[model samples]
Target: MLSLRTRFTALLIISVVLVLVIAAVITAWLLRKPPEVMYDRVLAEKAEFALLLLRADPLAAQTLHITIQEKPAKDRIDQDRTDNILAEGRRQGYTADVVVLKSFNPHRWDIAIRLDDGRWAYLDFPDPAPFPYLPLAAYLALVAIGMTGIATYVSNVMMRPLRILDETIAKIRPDGIIHELPETGPMEVRTTAKTINRLATRLNAAVSSRMRMIAAAGHDMRTPMTRMRLRAEFVVDGDDRQSWLKDLDELDHIADSAIRLVREEISPAAQEQVSLDAVLRSVAEEISETDLPVEQGAIKPVLVKGAPFALKRALRNLVVNAATHGLGARVSLSRYGGEAVLTIMDSGPGIPQDLLGRVFEPFFRVDQARRQIVPGAGLGLAISQEIIESHGGTITIVNRREGGLLQTVRLPLCKPEQD
Candidate 1:
């Protein structure tokens, strides 16, 4: 599909060309007759008039500047132009032989009319140059070029508002933050910017309200959870006490995860250059102490700009997720282009293809059975995604063809000065 600016410019050029073509055709039709025909006819009429006056009074005709000749003038006229003059003279009822002669001056023409007494009456008259089609074509081409330039300028001016709108909208962050647009330019542009600003204000308010509600609910749940745990400790039967404590512990984990997820959404932590290889190695070593199989491979020093603690937490969640769910994890870090690329591979069963898209959704799981096998609320992936995206990074999960799952994380590398 063509853009609006391109379409507008093309339409304008086409319209101008069509108008020019039509005007040219009309002008050509109106001037179809050659100027020589009219010039010859006028000369022929003057020669005839001079002959009539010469027969009546020779001296008076001589005073009229009529040059009487015994034979035709030596100056030659073009055959086609002579024929046209003859035809025109015949149309005016003069069947006598008529001859048109060229003059020494290009702007004058002489004509000879055979007199009744076998003499020739010669007369000279002004002539005009023929109609110019070549110059007209050149003029039309110049006009077309000028019109094309004007069309391009007008199209750019008209589409400026839309271009500005697109660029401003692209700057909007995924965290529901809206940057106000400058309400300048034409009236239409100003009105559009005002409307977008109003919509953004409402959207920001709604997102803030929701985040606050979730954070408040998570914080409020901790008081009751502490009370329930204290009550669970006093249960008589060992099995019942254990069951109650386990349920309370799960509820506590859920609240903590919920609060942390909300905090990840709202946190604007300061960022600095951090070594990704060190973070990966530390996570691997810490997980290894817990008897979780996490092997480091191809660890390369890569510096990226982000909060060190947040980056560590996100990486740890991914590593722990793979180790716990996918049996064991193999991690690698390297610099690819201007980005730090990290890969986590595991040997356990991969997620179903149908449920892969929902992995980033909060509290979403492949199946309810995993909820029993895995602990805490299913917000690890969601929180990690928020953290990664906040730091201008990306994370993706895909089922490996051989077996298990592959988790890939890419973060833009910092400048050499930051390292």
Candidate 2:
């Protein structure tokens, strides 16, 4: 389906051009008949005026020098001839077109005028051909050309505001900062922009509220966490003490993850041109330091438009999550169509079928019963999805047939704006 802007432009331009074309056609048709009518009127007037002069004085006919003859000398074969003469003449103070006659030349028009003495005055001349069609066709062609240009110009002017609206709406996202729409253009366009700005204001306020709650919760937990850590220092060294410290450490990890999530949501790094291969290689190199058996596949210099740090963090999160569950991760980056494709595969046991779809939810954990295996909260996949999607990308995780979980991320290659 076409977008609203596209539809409007198409409809507007087509309607205008069609109307103009129709008008031009009708005008051309009407013009064609007028030439024939005008010629008949002039021919009748000339014959009538000559009849009037002769009726007043018979010698006036012989005195006339204009080209009128009882029989044209240019006559050839009598293939076409008339059988009547003055019988078709009009006597009601006006003259009609001349009547045809048998004696008239076959190739020329024959006109008969009734004189006062009840005699027939025969006049013959070749018919004037209808006006040539080329000029009329040219006039219509010019009209069509002008109509096309006018329609295009009008459509562009009208669709300009809607194009701006589309661009503004596309740029709106939870990542980075919210930018207001430009309240300009036509009245309807200005209204639409203001409405979008109001909606953005409401959305930003909601996000701010949630982020403040997360920040506050993280802040409030720090003092108690510190006091608990200090108290644990007095405990005697034992397995139970180790378990308590581990549990507290996990709680601290959750708080820290929560704070980072809120901070990232509030302000992801600004977008810029960055190399996808570079970010993937850097993240894989750091993960390899932990001896996780991660491999960085051959990557090209695929420059993407996004925040480099945010993308790096997203890649790191996917790798770290895969490493924690699936033993280790193998990372690779490549180009597909107009998108940058990033794949992360892990060798550990993949998530259960029932929990696979829910893994990306905030703080969702598949291994709830195996908390000791992984101490962090279940925000890694969720955060990674947020980061990727904010940059106009998609992240999906599926279990590989061979083994382990496979995550695929695809980000659209940004195009430059035209001047």
Candidate 3:
């Protein structure tokens, strides 16, 4: 699983790529239009002027013909003069076409001259400078590169704040520690950063306050619990004493449950690399010593970085719960992909479908025939979930089709298989 910062960076890079692609597309569209269109328009207007001059001074036309042929009419047009004509055309937003033909028939020329007055005028000119493909292609390529660079720069700039936000959020611990996000970037981005930081602060304060209250309550109740136990021991009658002792034991159980709940909620980070197989074997052995029909699978050593004690406690809770409520308990451990999975199957009646999600909540128990049969404060699954989650893992319970409850715990593997 990638960290939030890495994921955000990847998304930003993809967005940059997308923006660059769009910019490249728009640049290509703008660059693809023929460069010759402007040149042709300029030439056409010059040809029309030349023809009009010829009509005005017919004798001058012969002199101009000698000069025009020696220095082609296209060549006779000055560079500055052509530029001025194009600039003027742009100012007026007009488009013209110029075609020059060499060694043309006088009759066809006359027809073209007559047509010029009628709007079908075809001024044929000699092939102008070889198609300007090299310069046009170079210009378009430069434009594409510039556009792509700008797009990439803007994308990087836009992504910087988000990257910082992601990094800040990733630093937040599950125990609800808040890390402030940087308040920078565009107006909208700055607003988002402030909102996220405020949310984190609120959540942290809420979780810390709740955990402190639970811890304080659990701590305060222990002295009263001890005093009550001491008082219960002094009951006179044998049956009455036993009943009072049982009540005291129940009170002790309640105190233990309360303390365990608070501890799980405010657990400190104590993760380390541990062998999953060893932990499972130890749990199975302890359970088997109690005469429970607990079976073990062909175990492989799977290394994972996590709170080993918490994991063991979680697994033990599952096994004990199963043994107390189900016909038998069977535990299996295996590696799948980059994760270590420990599945504990029991022959107990499965939980109701609707209650499966609620089973993880503290003190939530399913109402069923076996509800009273099991001795629990309903915190077993909740504790198990807390332990697993603290180790960056998950515990899920599902009904087996073969008629039982199946609890699967998945922990990320620390050691990957070498190919």
Decreasing lDDT order of the candidates: 1, 2, 3
TM-score of model 3 relative to the true fold?
0.65
If scored against the real structure, what TM-score would every candidate get? Answer: 0.84, 0.68, 0.65
Candidate 2 ranges beyond 4 A from true positions: 21-52, 62-64, 67-81, 84-137, 173-176, 226-247, 267-293, 296-313, 333-342, 347-361, 365-373, 385-404, 408-419
Number of the predicted model whose lDDT against the real structure is largest: 1
Can you write out model 3's per-residue Cα lDDT over 1-419, one digit (the tens) per residue?
97554555566656656665676677766656556556545554565566666557756645645232222345433355345445565555544322333334432221122223333233344433444557656765676566556655665666666666666777766455777777876886788789888888898889878877866786787788788778877877889877777766665665577678668768655779888899989998999998887888667788999877877888888888777676788888888899888888998778889888897877776764444455466778777877787777878889999988998899899979642
The C-alpha lDDT values of all candidates are 0.84, 0.73, 0.69
- Candidates sorted on TM-score, descending: 1, 2, 3
Q: What overall lDDT, based on C-alpha atoms, would model 3 receive against the true structure?
A: 0.69
Give the better candidate number (1 or 3) by lDDT.
1
Indicate the worst ten consecutive residues by lDDT in candidate 2.
80-89
Mind giving the per-residue lDDT tens digits that candidate 2 earns over 164-189? 66777677675534689889877877
Q: Is candidate 1 or candidate 2 better by lDDT?
A: 1
Query: How badly does each model clash, as a count of residue pairs?
Result: 0, 1, 9
Estimate the overall C-alpha local distance difference test score of candidate 2: 0.73
